[model samples]
Target: MAKFIINGGKKLSGEIKVSGSKNALFPIFAASLLTEQPCRISNVPEIVDKQVMVHLLADLGVQMNVSPHEVLITAANINKTDLNPELTSKLRGSVVLLGALLARMKRVTMSFPGGDSIGKRPIDSHLQAFEALGAITQANGVIEISAEKLVGNKIILEESSVTATENAILAGAMAEGQTVIKLAAMEPHVQQLCEFLNKMGAKITGIGTTTINITGVPKLHGAEIDLIPDSNEAASFITLAAATKSTVTVTGINPEYLDDFLLKLKNMAVNFEVGKDFIEVNAPTVDYQAIKIQGGLYPKLASDDIPAMAILATQAVGKSTMNEWMYENRLGYATELMKMGASVEAVDSHNVIFTGPTPLKGDKMTSSDIRMGITLVIAALVAQGQSEIEGVEHIDRGYENLEERLSKLGAEIRRA
Candidate 1:
């Protein structure tokens, strides 16, 4: 495993463009299977997860033309319905294919999906949604799902799970009848998937809302699309700028998607300006105030961004409370931060209390997960001494060329 050797206390400046959304691209990749024609997607980030996703698609006999930041996938002839167990286990996002494959071939078999060890991320929602859409599931260590003919039905998700909603939408897109989804996830990535499906001739309405309707078509045609800029990545850089009191402008960001996060930054008195497609963080306020932060469903702070917000809280003047009920171990990074001299108390599995204006000194740390890894990188950038962060692979899964990108922004970070 590669490690990041970062010399902290360096102010970062210059404009850094956020990469295409990893979350958005995964579903788009899976959705390509709905059509036999070629689907070309631009703005594809070269992340490890994308690599894994492409491999999985290739294993299914989809012909692909992949380049830096671009991919053209032609699922002209898919030879396999069973997902490769080893490849499928490496990526949690692989679960989205369950719906996509079912829509195309009506049969898919796979073992449990794997991802970061944040907490329990169950696929019960996916299976339940499929069952509601007239698919039968058999599970005994491995899962075998098949549908004779999918007929859409009203599905009220167990929770507003993004992937589950994507799965339901994918299956509903090609089902025989109209499918109604209530209490669906309205995340930006979910919206992107909906829009992309519509572009491919799937009739979907009530986008950006809890309730969505899909009129199933017999088949979906391939279409080209551009992936949206990753909001989580934009949030990470914004936090990095504020944590180090740097002047960094993050471009290619849709400010609308980051409203809650930006509001939190504004409340903290962090100096930042939001443009049509950019957010520039100037020198941070001298005495930033601590604020309460909660992670919830969309329009609220995203659970993925909670870790970066926690790092920002560490530099605030007063105590800040972090409530992340979405994942049990999302705040596991608090202990690693404590090692770097931050005042942190793990109040409970779901809550954390941070007391700040603490000068962090570099310490050895592990990256644990994607969000946790980037959070540590931001923390290390502002720390006093050099820090060695292991598990760079986890960071690469989400952020594309992160060390190289941050280095160009004047950060003294190097992959070792």
Candidate 2:
């Protein structure tokens, strides 16, 4: 197993470019299967989850020409419908392939998908959405979905789940009639997928809104697109700079996509400036104010960012409470933070309280999930001594070349 050894108290100063969206790339990759023509996508990140998706698509006879920054995928000769369980089980994004494959091949069977173990993330919404789209679903140990001919219908999602919304959009794009999705996810990545689909002959509209309309077409063709920079990554970098009182700039990101997080930073008295396509954060106040973080749908604080905010809270002046009702185990990292001398109380599975200006002392810890892994790295970078973090593979699943990138920013971090 790989570990990240860090010598804390280094003030990171430099510009770091944000990577391509991990959430957006999965649906786009799965959508490529909708066409036989070659689809080229640029600005692809070399994350572990992406490699897992590439392997999964390859197992289905899809050919890919992968480079450092892009992938040219040709799914013209796909020969299988049952997903390889080994690959599928390692990536939660593999679940999006169900709607894509069912639309292209009329059937799909695979075991449950997996990724971060932050909480009980069920696929009930996805299965329910597929059923609404004229597909027959069988759920036991293995999940099977098939449709003789997918006919469009009105789908009101049980929850605004991002992956569930992507699946519905993928299937709805090629479903026989007009499909309307209500209470859909309005995430930037979700909107990016809809835009890519439209370029490939899918008549989709009302993007970046809760209600989406898809006019199904008989077939789709190949298209090329560049992915948006990852807003979550931008938020993480800003959190790191603020926690360590560093001056850092994150470029290649759309500031509009990160309004919620940026607003939170402003509320906490973190000095930051947003430009056309970049964010430069200066050192925060010596005694910053603590504020509550309430997680909700888009236009609100994302649950994925809660851990980073929690790290910031440790350096704030008062008690900061985080309410993340979306995921039961979102606060699962509190114990790990406590080990590093943070004053944290896991109020429940969904809520946590952090009290601060606490001086963090480094300690050995284990990562539990992707966001938690990076959150610990930020904590370690801001701590008083050396810290060692195990299970960095979880970190690699999201951020690409994290240690190297942070090293460029002058962090004393190395892989061992």
Candidate 3:
């Protein structure tokens, strides 16, 4: 087991280059299985979640090589259609392979996926999309699916679920006709996936909207794609700078994708400058007004960001509220924050209220998930005295070389 022994009250300052999107690359990696040629992806993050994902792909007979910043994947010799049960249980992203497998070999079997238990993430949309595309689905302890001939049609997703929508798009890419997806997820990562598929010869329009159109292609050729910087990680650093009232610049980020979070930062009179590809945040140690935020679908705050937002709320002068509608279990992180002397109330599963300007005193804490794990580290950074944060592995599953990166910005952190 690894731990982060953090001496808090350090003001972080300097530039940190963000990594590629874990959310974007995982699905893209799964989508590569749809093609026989090699698909190369650059700007890949070196994190544990991706390692788990890569292992799952390797088990399914996909050939790949990983460098620091790129991965070349070729699926020419795929020897399996069913996913490894143990491997799939380790990654939620494994569920995405349902569409790619059904598209390539027309059969797939897998048990339920396990990821961060932050919410009730159902794959009904994925199964429904496959069934709409002419696949048959049978659900038992393990789910089994097979399709004779996929006939593309209109798919209307009940919720703006990102992975389910990507599954639909991957399966629809090879269907016999046009497939129109309504009420689709329009998150930037989803658009990036669409762009990647388009580069590989799939016709997809409606880049950032609720309605998306896809025309099936006989075959897709391999293409090299560079994933955009991880906006979620970017949000984490931005909140860290603000929570500690430091001046830090995050580079290689898409300011356009950060609108949902930046608006809230601006409302609190937090200081920041946005460039085309970067955002620099500087938080003064003085008091700021409390604010209310709601996390939701694309063009809005993402649920993964709620933990960081809660940390930001803790630095304000008065009471602040964060309403999370995406996940029922997300607010559980507040218990750990309270151990560091934060004044937080978990109002049921979907809401949390933070009474601000609490002088956090660092202490021992456990990590529940990836996002919340990083949030705890951020809180420890600003908390007075020392704190031992276990579950550093959870933080490692997302952020790459987190201690090294923060050390460059003057954080007193060491990995144990």
C-alpha lDDT of all candidate models, in order: 0.92, 0.91, 0.89
- Model 2, 1-416: lDDT tens per residue? 99999999888899999999999889999999999999999999999999999999999999999999799999999999999999988998899999899989999999999888767778888888888888999989999999889999999999999999999999899998999999999999999999999999999999999999999999999999998998888889989998999999999999998778888888889988999999898986556889988878997878888888888999988999989878787676789899999999878888889999898989999998899999999999999899999999999999999999999999999999
Report model 1's TM-score to 2 decimal places: 0.99
lDDT of 2: 0.91
Q: Give the deviation of candidate 2 from the true structure as CA RMSD.
A: 0.9
Candidate 2: residue 18 lDDT (0-100): 97
Q: What's the candidate order when arranged by decreasing lDDT?
A: 1, 2, 3
Among residues 3 or more apart in sequence or in different chains, the pairs in candidate 2 whose N, CA or C atoms overlap within 3 Å are none
Stretches of candidate 1 exceeding 4 Å from the true structure? none
2 against 3, candidate with superior lDDT:
2
Q: Model 2 misses residue 201 by how many Å?
A: 0.6
Model 1 lDDT per residue over 296-396, tens place: 88998899888988888898999999998788977878999999999998889999999988999999999889999999999999999999999989999
- In model 2, the Cα lDDT at residue 66 comes to 97
Candidate 3 C-alpha lDDT tens digits along 25-141: 877997898899999999999998888888888998889898887899999988988788998887888888888899989999999988887889888888999999999998787
Clashing pairs in 1: none
